[model samples]
Target chain A: MSDRLPGFSTLAVHAGAQPDPTTGARATPIYQTTSFVFNDADHAASLFGLQAFGNIYTRIGNPTNAVLEERVAALEGGTAALAVASGHAAQVVVLQQLLQPGDEFIAARKLYGGSINQFTHAFKSFGWNVVWADPDDIASFERAVTPRTKAIFIESIANPAGSITDIEAISSVARKAGVPLIVDNTLASPYLIRPIDHGADIVVHSLTKFLGGHGNSLGGIIVDAGTFDWSTGGKYPMLSEPRPEYHGIRLQETFGNFAFAIACRVLGLRDLGPALSPFNAFMILTGIETLPLRMQKHCDNARAVAEFLAGHPAVASVSYAGLPSDKYNQLARKYAPKGAGAVFTFSLKGGYDAGVNLVSKLQLFSHLANVGDTRSLVIHPASTTHSQLDDAAKVKSGAGPDVVRLSIGIEDKEDLIADLEQALGA
Target chain B: MNHDAYPDNYIRGILNSVKSIAMVGASPVNVRPSYFAFKYLAQRGYDMIPINPGHVGKELLGKPFVASLRDIGRPVDMIDIFRNSSHIMPVVEEALTLDPLPKVIWMQLGARDDAAAEKAEAAGIKVVMNRCPKIEYGRLSSEISWMGVNSRTLSSKRAPAPTQGMRLSLNRMSVGGGDTAASDRAAKNKSEQS
Candidate 1:
């Protein structure tokens, strides 16, 4: 293929797939088997030795999943990609490769509450530390970086609160410290932003959300831009040092550009065993096919909803980057020109009780913990996701008690507004 | 098909004994299949030495190019030929002349020569013609099944659980495995209490 690349719509449909070679099936078949038969013992030896590449078991790799991996890698302009069980699994595996025991990584404070909980509590058990930095303040990222910092993580569009991150500015800080910049592009998806174009070394996604567009599949992906030199200063041993388990093969010296992706597969996913089942892979792949159409509609409806909320007397504040009045509007214009994504929050004038009441009254919007579904969704973080966090911590995480988060869907704008209007009870 | 399918044990033996490979006609150009094959094998931890006379002094994927298989300085265990049908004989002839000849001669896709194969086999070197090491690795490793191709082997037993940290679950209800608020609270309380 020449430099004139295929458009997003085309890549979403065809990138890592071809008609089924065996049966001539147009759709990718789900290979549900756990292990594959070897041609002979030598073929098996080469596979086990890393002297060759192939799926040994579903836990390590699968046929249906590989297609999804390639499709996302192609869309993100990454050299290679790895597909895992969920969006959170993507973060865990990516860090598993980067952070050694007792090491640290900097993350933006404005992240999904689930991620904040994951990084703050779950990761600590693995001996990995999270140093929080304000995404709005680029300098805060630089200051958070210490000698132990292996990576810097941020969401392209901060969850709950629709905010765009200054990826280029923060990437520079990561560059100065000789670490990779990883951007979680789940909310914006590749339709709105390709973080690699903005200097991110790796782009991650919760494919279950917008990419799947249906919220029916639980999947995650790690896309390696193949930019970072893992061998530099020999900080990343999992990639640099000879792995004794794999017969003393050093991943970086061998893999080069796709080494990080390879490391995540053989080292992280292999050991952690958070493998995506082939059935889920097939569903997520089907969902990705309509990502472009669904994302555009999701943004259009969200822009309308954010505007409606901004005007409502019952609403205290609408934190949607699509609105010019919102704090992240300028950054949204620069980073996500298509739109600032569909998931955003609006605080109620009645505070905690109003936020809870508004969600309960909404007829169309499902009150659920998930996002990026075709149907709109609403949640009160103060009562559910962020309930455990103290008030001071909750505010810092953009999930204050007065906030009501909405994951606007690809429905008609007028119908969505009417539902919200009735729910506001004005 | 000009290439013979060797026994599984023989192929396995060759791959296991060999440590380094000298890829003849290796290209630095990204679009070429040779470049990818070279990259994939190198990443799999093979000491892949790319031999390209055209880009004599240049580096492909960080490793400097060598003028010929003989110029790799160390003992090359395998010679992976990426040249066409007409050039295979000459490439094999060059491989035979090296002080420590390669133990195997692998012809890339469409690069086969019966005479060269006879020569290499006569020299007690294993010969795999019109086949790619990259493809062979994947096929043998069972990794190629991800493409919906049939993996001839079948087993009924499930893969054993990982011995390390908590097992990750991807079910719809609990997406990050055990990332429920209750677990978070427990972990948080423990941290504060400590």
Candidate 2:
């Protein structure tokens, strides 16, 4: 709202939110209705024709969801945002807009196991294909690209292993291929890394995780950097072609910078029908207000835990990039100077039994399939999240039988360590 | 915002009353948009009749495929046209020949014909053009709100549902789907043996 750029915390609190004109409501109230009343006949026509901007229906747009979308877009330095039901839903809609039938997209090999399942299995049903490349080997990404490749997808900070992807290097491959680079910034959030600033054209998030800062709601968002030239080659027809649905108006021509976001909402979300509830939007927005405070503590506590585990005789390995001895320490410093985030993995010398036992024994941590909460969480991924994946996939995702994932929260350092110590029986 | 564009009340009413849908031009191929729409409609508990000529007597989503609207041999509530714009007239003509004519003639995202719409309306049937049923069901039922988007209408009231021993966690975490600790132990033991 001002010429002077406000800090992240301020944007988290104030962006896209103002006092309610009708009721002076300070807190964002959930607009829980199925339909909004029209002022006049002509007004309704304009909204549907895309001639005017307002809430038409919840599936397409809503005022409260608009606030969350704006807050996230501002924080991520994107032109606009479209919030959806889950991280998986965001990915579905993002790819739906980019790829047609039989088209392929290259993805970094190291990623959240659920994402791997989504890309490998569920997406195939939609006729979209995935070609995998190891994040460690940047050249693998280049080799995977073909004329049919429509986009390049990677994570800012990969899940489980806490590895930092070379966003800049992969972005070059995407640019050369004349495709957009999509980065899932769920782990890093905008606090640790802004993928768009480096070279990413689009950023996606599962606000159900850290951005919500609580494990209470499931939500996701797609932020359009508004940088890609959708009209460059006419490859993306959804954005460039005329649409009979909305009176043949090309989305890119009408909604300039954030045309991708518009297409996702109007076409993808409209048909797929994964709309985020306003109640969830309210909760996520509330969680994000204190993101700056929570993220710093999460990093500090995680660094301490990684160090403790690395030295433990019973611990076989610790895989947090925050640790000086970790393989991704330099990348972490370069990409996420503030911290390498709070989710990391470690393996036990006692093996599978020890991994399962540690999760069950931790008092301060809740054993569940979630991360980025105010409360510490732990899970044996092999027996839970990645239980569905095969052994090869488990290893590729950094979720092996001996591995235990830790989502360090904003708890006291000593308390978390005490819980870990008791759990480890050291 | 143009208020006259989407007739919310009209669409909502049709979605509420409609029960069964005969999806014409439905495909068995997973990649086809018709296939996804058919699956989504079926998942939403719609009695789906997939009409694909080549796949007659075959099954899509466990619903036996029919060669045409007349071949359904049952009272069809709605005829969802997934065919191209050029095919709308024949589809509507065939839909009219059903034993009990369908109450609605719905067109998919890009399929629309004013002549067919007029014909259907003259027969006292509702016509929804250039729209999708999968999306309409979500909007009408308020299920789309699960994704964190605002539904726009606000109320302090909530519908009661059956809940027992369920802790209201921050994230809407549900109880286990009957997977017991024994199962995990068995899986782990099998892995260890290998």
Candidate 3:
């Protein structure tokens, strides 16, 4: 009644959750059921025909996941969102709606190595060609735009390196090319940078990262900004054309702004069958309640670690945008004013052996392929996550043999600094 | 004024306030979206008037059809435009000519014309674009949740079952919130037993 919109922290806590209707449980209860019972034959028929909204099967939707979807949608300022099994599943589902077989999508060369692999191998086999572009070179995205291009993909903060991308510049290119700009906001999270606010039409996240905060759950979400006109030029037939499965209803015409989320749900997730478990959704939802507090600490701790690494004798350079001397510092200030995020790469003066040795010598930092945990994580990506890529590809993705990627967690800054010092010294 | 997202209260207000609605471009065929919306709203006890040049002499769901807003002969509470975006300006201009202009001008899903919305809003008419009333009604009434749609609203209170007919109310008390009188009583009773 006050006409005041809820603030970020308030929305984070209460956006999509309510006390139980049947029981008074304050926390979101895991429905934990596969299918929901209908009132009668008409209710079942309406749901199947997309004439009504409700839970039919777990593969399509669930109440617990709906709450998570709404919470993320509210946080990102998007019209709707869909939760999936993993970040890779979110990408596959998102692209399935946009790209047909043989259609091409332009992507930033610097990305999560897993994503690069998926785009190159898995997507390629489906006839979805990925045209690589340089995120640092804005014109490269424009150049990669061919008639067959359906979408442009980038990261809000590039993985491993923690570099900032000029989202507005690429958004201009996407607007000109008549394509939606899909930004992977997994690294930055909504607490730091909301991609939708920076001209991203669709924002995807690996909820295993900062959003879940604790890194205890593996989930992914795709938020629909509802900015792109999918019906324009009839380029996106999946939305504009009638969907054969749902009684020939055109999604864009029926659902309007949230049609992309609906298509990803009814078409992609429903068929592909990579639905997030109710328990995982509940775990992630609990994690998100503390997102604002945890994300800030993660940023603060990361800055301290980056500064220490930059001054260390064994370190050649720190790639965190939080450092003033970093190449992406200005862009980071413009886009993520709060902080440059936690995951960043640093190179060792001792080269590949030193990078590998430091990981084993670390006391507190866990040497793992994952990031965005409550505990500090260190990874020699070149030998692990990015090992499949060739030498040039590895270096291009900021996972050079000498580079060490650290996901600084919400720990005592001095303790984190001391651990790095002992490891670098040894 | 941001048509991209409308608060729940704003939409609930429009649906609650409006009684009679004239749906422009309404179709007699059951397959069309306009027909579905018209049928749904009619069943919900609204004064639904269908307006279509092609279906002027026909009846839709036991209601007579008129060719245009001008032929309705009675003032409407709202004008639901189901036409193409390019065709909105003329229909809005016609709505303004009525003795007591409609309280709202609603563009159906995928039908948006910002210029027309602005013009109507300037004349003291509320405008909502690129949305469907049927969806909003089901969403606000928690009827859509029966089918598993994310209404983006949370309520712990169960919606009251229809007493007589298969109709739900837009003016229901449980629009949002988990802590309602019924839910509170249920919680209190459970605690006592436990």
Candidate No. with top TM-score: 3
**Using lDDT as the measure, what is the rank order of every candidate, best first?**
3, 2, 1
Steric clash pairs (candidate 1) = A37-B153, A42-B12, A53-B138, A54-B143, A55-B142, A55-B143, A63-B146, A254-B43, A255-B43
The parts of candidate 1 lying over 4 Å away from their true place are A1-3, B1-194
For DockQ, the strongest prediction is 3
Q: What TM-score does model 1 achieve against the real structure?
A: 0.73
* Candidate 3 lDDT, B1-194, residue by residue in tens: 76655666788888888999999999875556886788778767789999988876779877888988889888899999998777899999999999889999999876678788899999999998767899888766655543334454544444454432256754433323321122123223332333
lDDT of 1 at B76: 88
C-alpha DockQ of every model: 0.06, 0.01, 0.14
Clashing pairs in 3: A53-B147, A53-B148, A53-B149, A54-B147, A54-B148, A54-B149, A55-B147, A55-B148, B156-B178
Q: State the lDDT of candidate 2 residue by residue for A1-426, as single tens digits.
A: 112335677767766665554676777778887777766775576457654345678988777888898778778877578999999999999999999989999999888889988999999998999999999999999999898999999999998788999999999999889899999999999999999888899999999989998889999999888667676678999998887777677776455456688899999888899999989999999999999999999999999988998988899999999988889999999999999999999999999999888887888899988999999999998988888888988998899999999999998989998999999984
Highest lDDT: which candidate?
3
Docking category of candidate 2? incorrect
TM-score of each: 0.73, 0.69, 0.89
Q: Give lDDT per model, in order.
A: 0.78, 0.79, 0.84
TM-score of chain B of each: 0.76, 0.74, 0.84
Candidate 3 lDDT tens digits, A17-115: 766656767788899999988888866775677765567999999989888888888788776789999999999999999999999999999999999
Worst 10 residues of 1 chain A by lDDT: A1-10
Poorest 10 consecutive residues of model 3 chain A by lDDT? Answer: A1-10
Native contacts conserved, per model: 0.08, 0.00, 0.17
